[model samples]
Each structure stands twice: as C-alpha cells, then as structure tokens.
Target: MKLQQLMSQTRRAIDDYGMIHTGDKIAIGISGGKDSLTLLYALHGLQRFYPEKFDLEAITVDLGNPDFDLSHIRHLCETMQIPYTVVKTEIAQIVFEERKEKNPCSLCAKMRKGALNDAVKKLGCNKIAYAHHKDDIVETMMMSLIYEGHFYSFPPITHLDRTNLTVIRPLMYVSEADVKGFCRKYQLPVVKSPCPADGYTKRQYVKDLLRKLNLENPGVKERMFSAIINGNISDWTPRIR
Candidate 1:
C-alpha cells in the first residue's frame, strides 16, 4: 500500500474515534516492527495535512536484548524530524532469567507497557498511539473468545485513568497485509524482534487459525471486523460521519 492509502485509512480511524485534538501531543509506541513503523509513517504523513494539529513523538521500551538495535530507528526518526526516546530496562532479564515464567508474554508485555507508559507520561503526552491493526483486533477477539469465553476486543480508544493517558489505535482500519506492503514500498527500517517468545505465543496460534479459517471461508476477517465495530461491545461503535 502507498503512503496515501495508509494515511487515508489511518485518518478514518482517527476521525471516527475522535482520537486527536488541536495542540495535543501524541506518542507513538515503537516496537521496531513493521506495524509500528507503518503507524509512524502514516501519522507523520497525516500530520502534514490533517486539520487538527498534533505533535508526534516515538518511544520504544528497550528490553535490554543485545540483538535489539535502535540506531536505524533513531536515524529514521531524525530524518523525519520526530523526537524519539528509548527507555532502557532489564525486562528481558527479569522475565526470562529471574522470574522464568512459563508464559512470559503476559509479564513481559506488562513490564514493557509500564515502561512505555511511564516514558510517555514524562514526555507530557496526553495520548499514546499503538499500531494494532485490523488483523490484531480480530485475533485478539478470537483469543478472548477461545481463552476467556468472551466475545470482545480492545477499543480504538481507551482511557487509562491510572496513568492519565488515553491510548489510541489509529491504524485500526489498516490491515496487516497493507502494513507489510507499505513497509516494503517505503523501505522502512524494519528491525527484527529479538524476544524469545516472538512466535510461540497464543496470539500466534490464533493468527494461524484465523488465517486458515479465512482461507476456508473467504471474507471472514472482514465480516468479523465489521461485527466488532457494530457489535456494541464496549466502545467499538464508530462515530457517525
């Protein structure tokens, strides 16, 4: 997908959820993955023309993995004139070495997001943007259903009262396939994840299962996404245009 197309979808989600406001500073959580990088590019592009003015900052929580590099990411942010900050933490050690939890994803994510949220709050950002796309939304819903016995997924916007920060997912309308295409076309500096549980998580299982189900029953993903927005689950309802 081209930058124009990405921006179009991102803008729709932003507007639909009332995500941004004039003079609002938004922080983008950079995981050094394609989804987050695509979000960075999309939001940067949208900033150029979107009527509601906002500032963008990129923040990454460094899990203290030796293989994880941020030099390329720093260069990308510098080239785009966006402020970038990486919070260094020994989360990898704590989760893998010290705690040694069998299911490390939960603990690791909590630590990572805690770090990210702290950094974002320090930066005076009222809202933080995550790169959860259409596929992620569907996968999360399926995971909740299969594991927690609930037909639910995260909302596009969530207010974390504890942190006093509102989380926004502007890429909710963009698909993972389009994210890959945009990254490839724009030659984004994609960084490979060094986490040990990269592909061994329950989400990955659900992702594969959803892919197979989609193949067997075409348009299932789209219908599921449509159902999410119209399902009246929490704040999934879209704003009237």
Candidate 2:
C-alpha cells in the first residue's frame, strides 16, 4: 500500500476513536516486525500534518533473544527523526530458561507489555500505539470465543487506569495484508522476531482457522469486523464524530 492510503486509513481510526488530542505525546511500540514498523512509518507520516500536533517516539522491548537485532530499526528511526529507545530485558531467558513454561506466550506478553508500558511512561508519553490491525482484531475475537467463551476484541482506544496511559491502535482500520504490502513497497527495514514460540502459538492457530473460514465463507472477516464495530460492547463504541 502507498503511504497516502496508509495515512488515510490510520486517520480514520484515530478520528473515529478520538485517539489523539493537542499536545499528546504518543509512543509507537516497535516490535521490529512488519506490523509495528508499518505503524511507526504511519505515525511518522501522521505527525507531519495531523491537526492534533502530537509528538512521536519509537520503542522496542528487547526480549533478550540473541538472534534479535535492532540495527536496521535504529537506522530507520534516525532517518525518520523519531526518538527511539530499546529497553533490554531477560524475558526470553526467564520464560524459556528459568520458568520453561509450556505456554510462554501469555507470560511473555505480560512481561513485555509491562516493560513497554514502564518505558513509555518514563519517556513522558501519555499514549502508546500498538500495531494490531484488522486481521488481529478478528483473530483475537475468535480466540476469545474459542478459549474463554466470550465475544470480545480489543478496542481502538483503551485507557489503562493503572498506568494513566491510553493505548491506541491507529492501524485498526488497516488490513494486515495492506501492511505487508506497504512494508514491501517502501522497503521498510523489517526485522524478524526471534522468539522461539513465534508461529507455535494459539493465536497462529486461530489465524489459520480464520483464514480457512473466510475462504469457505467469503466476506466473513469483513462481517466480523462490522460486528465488532457495532457490537455495543461499551469500549468498542467509537467516540462521536
């Protein structure tokens, strides 16, 4: 996808959810993956002309994976002129070496988010943007229903009262496929995740299931997204335009 298309979709999500306000300092969570990098680029583009006039920063919480590298990511951030920070943690060692938990995704996610949140707060950012897109939304709702017996997905804007931080997904309206195309088109210096459990997670299973279900029932994904938007789940409700 072109940068113009990306900014259009991103702006829609932000406007629909009232994600940004004047003087807002937002941190972009950079996981070194296509999605996060795409988010970083999108936010950087938005910073150029967004009326709210928000500041941007990029952050990555290193999981202590030896194979993970941030050199390319650092260069990209420098080229964009966005402040970048990497918080080092032994999350991989703790999860895979010490705990050796059979299911590390949950624990790893919690620890990673905790580290990212703390970093964001310390950097004086009131809001943090995640890279979750349309595909993630559908997959998460599927996971919630199949695992926890609930019909739920994350909202576009979430206010974490505990940390006084607001989490926003500006890519909520953009599809994952579009993000991949954008990364390829722009030659984004994408970095692969070094987590051992990268593709062996429950979310991957749900993602495959959603893909098959969409193939069997065309427009299923779009319908599911529409349901999420109109589900009246309190948090899912967008701010008044």
Per-candidate TM vs. native?
0.98, 0.98
Local accuracy by lDDT, each model: 0.94, 0.93
**What tens-digit string does per-residue lDDT give for candidate 2 at 16-63?**
889899999999999999999999988899899988999998999999
lDDT of 1: 0.94
After TM-score superposition, the amount by which residue 104's alpha carbon in candidate 2 deviates from its true location, in angstroms, is 0.2
TM-score of model number 1: 0.98
Worst 10 residues of 2 by lDDT: 232-241
Residue 152 of candidate 1: its Cα lDDT? 98
Model 1 lDDT at residue 140:
94
41 Cα displacement, candidate 2 (Å): 0.8
Query: What lDDT is reached at residue 219 by model 1?
Result: 99
